[model samples]
Target: MNLTTTTRQRWAWAFYDWANSAFITTVMVAFFPIFFRKYWANGLPSEDITLHLGTANALASVSIMLLAPFLGTVADQGGIKKPMMAAFVTLGVCATLGLTLVGESQWQWAMFAFVLAVVGFLGANIFYDSLLVDVAEEKDFNRVSALGYALGYLGGGLLFAVCVLLTLKPEWFGLVDKTAAVRWAFGITAAWWALFSIPLWLWVRERAPAQAVRPSLPVLLRQSVGQLRDTFRHIRQLRVVWLFLLAYWFYIDGVDTVILMSVDYGKALGFADDSLITALLITQFIAFPAALVFGWVGNQWGAKRGILAGLAGYVLITIMASRMENAQEFYLLAGSVGLVQGGVQALSRSLYASLIPAEQAAEFFGFYNMLGKFAAVLGPLLVGWVGVLTGSPRLGLLAVLLLFGLGAWLLWKVPRD
Candidate 1:
């Protein structure tokens, strides 16, 4: 019943990032693209696979965005951020584990499970993001956020490396085959995610206004709707935050699209799956320190400047991606992505945390996350559309340049805090 040390609480809070990221790096970013296309959709056209994945991504984002505001509002009203986070984390872990049960012929079930895991991972993040205010001192926010992301890169990258070895050399792991290794990767990811989540659940306090009375479902529904409307109005009134949201929406679209599609892009170019996996590994490993440095940069130069720098780097990275030819060049692109990916995301989180009122952290983070979820949906669809239309993923990647441009331009309008 004793409280954990502040340092312990901070580390524990950040460990959640370390925990759930295995699913992201291993499943979503690396193996899943290959698994879905080559395994689940083996007989289907590549275009069909692209369309289905895009649709699934959009649907998951939509569902999460719709509920994020209400969830945030209720968690704030009831002081239940910790418990809600726990529930979502559990959902994510279970869904990931479910993926292990899906056979290669069961693309439908695979997609269903994948969606549930994404929902759980991203949904849990709504509350987890809010907790930044609770766990970090004002001055340390950037560093803490950066460290979370840095460790996330390290932790996710380490597990993914193991998965890579298991898949590439199954006999070394005593697995029957690569397919079995892949299935076991799903279970390993789930277990890793679940195990690392324990610290924050036990140590981090949920700081929210206590609910005076528990409401009926109807009453809760009405309150949530009203809260959403009020939030919409309130957001429009905050010019800097509004402008930042607009900017973030655009640039982050490019970022999310790139992360989601990079492996698929390589596959389209006929790069071997092993090469793509190794390239992704390069990004994850290199990003660990790069993320921490960005945090330090934010601390010294301010988060705004740090984020803008990252955006500029991404603009270059996106343009370069379209020109990538073979595996070596792909590895170069992956490493470039590593240098900015974690830093940009971490800086953005801290920067937004600085702008919002701490008292309404969860509620406001809800709106923030909704905008983010909406952004996630936009990027992939645009990529898919461009790919389908031009018959080239290179052209599809070219489409993301505009997103970064608009995001940077809008971001410039927001004054530094």
Candidate 2:
């Protein structure tokens, strides 16, 4: 690729993160979970609400784990990354927009909508992530990956701030109710994602040429299965990489669980919705610059070292969060998360990008994503289980420290190169 072409492709790829982040911010993190628990499932017990949400999320993760590798292989074979991404994004956007129809009386409908939206959101990421190699040289992957994540935070945060303002004062937006305002936010997220996805479809061409031998569906299936088997075999030879992945799996599980569950935990502890929302906003704003700083730091100290430093931050935050006594403290803890969240995650992606073969980027990223999903299941399940056993959410927060500690130990063993 020429200089101009490379620059355009990189920008297009990064913008996908910018585009879909609205859904992640508005629907997944900030508004919908609260909406689901409060209005959609009004009659349910708190435990049941938690369990149902957890189950829905877990199911979505499992579905993505099963499908992502095959989808990657198929995309690689058919040269259809752009189309696959389009299909999944449309599926996600439509499902998100459909949330407008959910009512206080329609819990089941809301649940199904959420499940579909989550599947679409996660499935779309498989193809989106695979486009990284096409966007930048190996030497520049860390910086480019960080740029994408920073844009993601900024874009998501901007939309989330708008949604928060509308949610807090729906009358200003000429909306009759807060619920309606929130519903409109979902619609906006869908539209935002759809519009931003257009550039990549139109401009960014795939780098790796498709194989000449196009197989039948049955043959494709057989080939993908064999590819998966070979992936496992190949991983066995990369012991250092495998170890780092295991470490990443555990630590990222803790990170993901904390992000997803912190709002609910705040609600349970009687913190106002505005307080939690403000904290999330803080994270978004802080993450934008911090991700770039982390990328620069990773380039100097090495990605693994940067990741270890972030893990240390996680351990400290988890301990402090476990002891929080007020909403103010929650905000403080949220600030800590903002400082490290994007940096850690972006560096991790860049590190993996360094280790994997360019040809196998999608297939290996599929494995990476699956393990991350599996970790998602484990972290939440453990937290929920611990909360049930101890009868205290604080104790469950402390339990997350174990993941960080274990991950740090394993990460320390990884070679810095």
Candidate 3:
């Protein structure tokens, strides 16, 4: 691709982040927990609801962890990354839009929809991430990754602001009730995802051409299995990459679980949905500029150093969050999270991209995603188990510091690109 074409394609790819982030912000992070607790689990005990949600999340993570690598391998070999991503995105968007039909009496349906959407969103990211190699030169990977994250923060933040406004003032939008307004917000997320996904489909041409790799289904399966085996066998040669993946797996778990579970944790401490939503909105906005700043810092210092600084901040925030006593503290925690979350994640992706081969990017990223999903199971389960056992979220929150510290140690050994 020429410079102009590459720039346009990169922006188109990044815009997908802008597009789908609304679902992540409005549906996954901000509103879904509130909807679950308030509307779904009306008669059930809070503990039971927490257990069920935790179990469902764990199950989804395990399922995705198992499937991601296989799908990534096939997509890479079959040259179907773009098509697979589109399918997953469509599936996720439809499932998100389906949230509109969920009602107080239909909590099960709502949870099911949420899980389906999560699966689609996460599964699609495997291929979406693999596209990085197609769009940018090695030197530009970090900046481009940062730009995508920055765009995601801004896009998600903008929609979150709108959703919060609509939620706070449903009557202003002529909605009959707050619940209906929230449902409308979900509908808007779906529409936004679908509409924004169009630019990538229209402009970012797929680089991998489909060729007839003739084999029966069984043969193809055997080949994929053999390739997986070979990849694992060769993993020793990729020791640095493996170490980075291991560190990323654990720390990102802490980051993702915190983002997903913070709202629930806040509610358990008596903060209302409005407060959590407002705090998340702050995170979204703060993360936009912070991502860019982190990108510059990564360029100036190094991705590893940038990630280390972010991890240090995470350790402090997680500890403080464990002891938080008021909504103000929650807002402070959210601000701290915004400052580091995108930077850590963006630099991690860029760092890995620099280490891996372009042709194997999808497969490696699939393994990366798998480890991430596998890690997702740990922090939440530990949190739920500890909270139930100890009757305090503080102990659970405190345990996350171990992950950060361990990740930092592992990261220290990863040689900088």
Candidate 4:
């Protein structure tokens, strides 16, 4: 590829972050829980709604957790990462669009669509993340990885701001009410996701596998299964890789849980929907710059130290969350979260990329995303069940401290690159 083409490929690859983050910010982190509570699952007890939302998140994550590694092997063998990503993006877009059709008090159908959307969103990430190596050299990992996340925060936040406006001033958009505006927001988000994703499909190209002749489907499946077995053994033999994965599994659980549940938790504490949405917007915009700053931090101080610093911030954030009262306090916490959220995530990806064999990036990232999804499974459930059992969302939020503390301890043990 020529210089222009290479540059386009790298930018196109990063733009996928801009594409998918709309769903994560506008729907998953902001609107879904609010809509689920007020509209879809109306008349249900608060705790019951929290449990149901948690179940949906856990179910979606479990599905991806089980399939990520296997699918990674198949994609690596077939050299079909882009094709697989297209399939999942289609799934996610359609499912998100489907949400607009779910009428009032149809929480079951809403849950169904939400689960499938989550699956599509996460399933696509396995391929998306693996492409990082294809787009940039190892020396550029921190900078390029952080660039993608920065775009994500900006892109996701911009759309979310529009959505918030739609909800707050439905008359300005010619909508019937706030609910209609929210439904329209869902449809718009789907379109944004589909539209922004086209650049990646057209510009970025995956490196072909070594095999010249393409294997038949049956042969590919057999090879994939065998490769997966070998990959498992490879992970076991790679001490730093496995150790880092263990640490990622723990800390990212807390991160994912907070992102997924913060709006709901705020609502549970009696904050208004407007306040919650504003807080999310705060995080997104703040994280946009913070992610870039952390990229520099990773390059200068090392990814390990950058990640460890982020984890310490998270520990403090979690403790503050447990004691938060009023919207002002919630906003403070949201700003705090933004400062470290993208830094931790971007550094983690770059850090892991440095540790792993780039030849089998997809296969190893499978395990990376697998552990991520699995950690997600534990987090929402922990918060949900703890709330259900203790009848205090505060206590459930505090339980996340354990994950951050343990993860930080383990990460400290990993040798610096």
Identify the leading candidate in terms of lDDT. 4
Candidate 2: worst-modelled 10 consecutive residues by lDDT: 206-215
Find the 10 residues in a row with the least total lDDT in model 4.
Answer: 205-214
* TM per prediction: 0.96, 0.96, 0.96, 0.99
lDDT: worst 10-residue window of model 3: 206-215
Give candidate 3 regions above 4 Å deviation: 209-222
lDDT (Cα, tens digit) per residue for candidate 2, span 247-351: 888888888888878887777677889998998998889889999899898888888888888889999999898888897898888889988988888888888
Which tens-of-lDDT digit does each residue in 1-417 have in candidate 1?
A: 233577888899999889988989998988888899988878987877887788778888998889898898877766778888889999989999998888876899889999999999989999999999998878999999999999899999999999988898999888999899999898999999999999998888766465577677677667767876887788899998888888888888788888888888888888998889989999999999999999999999999888889888998888887888789988998999999999889998999898887877888889888888898898888888889998988888888888889888988889884
Off by over 4 Å in 4: none
State the lDDT at 153 in candidate 2.
92
TM-score of model number 3: 0.96
Best by TM-score: 4
Error of 1 at 276 (Å): 0.6
- The residue-by-residue lDDT of candidate 3 on 173-194, one tens digit each, is 9998889988989999999989
Higher-ranked by TM-score: 1 or 4: 4
RMSD of 2: 1.6
